[model samples]
Target: MKVLVTGAAGSIGRVVTPGLAERGHTVVGLDRVPQPDGEDGAWYTVDCTDPDAVAAVFDEESLDAVVHLAGHPDEASLPDSLSSHVVTTAALLDAVHEHGVTRFVYASSNHAVGRTPRTDLLTVATRPRPDTFYGVGKVAAEALLSLYADRYGLDAVACRIGSFLERPETLRQLATWLSHGDCVRMVEAALTAPAPGFTVLYGISANTRAWWDLEPGRALGFEPQDDAEAYADSVAPDAPEDVEVDCVGGPFTSTAYERPALDRSS
Candidate 1:
């Protein structure tokens, strides 16, 4: 399968781009920044929000799937969040539709359902309770993907990724950390899953204390291999217990997120 990975220069992209190639897929990278040195694969520098530029990439390469990871990585003003996440997603979805791409694997975040209390295990069927403007953008993007899938018969998979890190550093991370190896595995499964139409998956590892259910991902052949429990003794000892323990969104749902919804300064 030929895959196009947006945000190929970012942290997750850096791991996923080459990782996909190692799994027998042809990878074509697209990002706003230039491809880093020593990175192997065909790459294109373009902002995903620009429909024409994104279309040009599709025109040039016959892609089979898209792993969309380009977007604002943190909480921001509502308009900025929408433009970064929703607008970029719309452009790519349009291009995917214009061409004959069959699969769309979005890098949606857990923040989409962050406001949900950590009272029970989270499942894909859980109602969306976005914690911030950034979270709202993710929810909106997922809705758009659903619309395109139903109308166009596309196989769209929204991955609600947890804390993607090299290792667990906090008490929450022990339950939420998505290992680098497992990140690649999750994407591979989503890309290769047979006819998974409009699916929602939690991108996490096989942790012993996971907050989100992994059954949905397993149903799609995403068997996560890593466990964050190994680091529990080390991290849990020093980790601070805070508001994050109250909800699945962690600190994102706290008073700190209550700020201006727009940035007026130029």
Candidate 2:
């Protein structure tokens, strides 16, 4: 399969782009930044929000699928969030629809359900309860994907990724960490899953302390192998007890995340 990965220079992209190639997929990288050294496959420097630029790529490459990893990586004003997440997504989806691409795999975040209390395991069926504007953007993007799936028969998969890190660094991470290897595995599964129409999967490892359910991912042939439990003893001794672990969103649901919707000073 030929895959186009947006944000190919970002942290997750750096890992996923090469990892996909290793798994026998042809990877084409797209990002605003110049292609980094040692990146395997073709690379295009373009912001994903520009429909024309994005369309040109579709015109050039016979892409089988897209793993959308671009967008604002943190909380911001509502408008900025929408432009970064929703607008970028819309442009790609339009191109995907126009070019007959079969599948789209989005790097959605767990913040889409961050405000939900961590009383029970979170499933893809959980209602949207975004804890921040960043979360809201993810939810909106997911909705747009669903619309495309329903109307155009696009196979879209939204991966609500947890803490994607080298390893568990904090108490919250012990439950939420998505190992680099598992991250690649999750994306591969999303890209290759047979006819998964508008599916949602939590992007995390096989952690013993996981708060999110993995059955949905497993159903799609995503069998994550890493467990954060190995590093628990090293991280738990200094774990802080606070709002970070109180909900699926951790600190994103706390008062610290509250801010003016607009930054007029600029």
C-alpha lDDT score of every prediction, in listed order: 0.94, 0.94
**Which pairs of residues collide in model 1?**
none
Per-model tally of clashing residue pairs: 0, 0
Best by lDDT: 1
Reference-based lDDT, residue 6, model 1: 98
Put down candidate 2 lDDT per residue, 1-266, tens digits, no spaces.
Answer: 99999999999999999899999999999999999986657999999889999999999999999999998799899999999999999999999999999899999999999999988888888899999999999999999999999999999999999999998988988889999999999999999889999999999999999999999999899999999999987886556567878898998988989988778886
TM-scores of all models? 0.98, 0.97
Task: Candidate 2: give the clashing pairs.
Answer: none
Q: In candidate 1, what residue range of length 10 has the lowest lDDT sum?
A: 236-245
Candidate 2 residue spans exceeding 4 A from truth: none
Name the lDDT of candidate 2.
Answer: 0.94
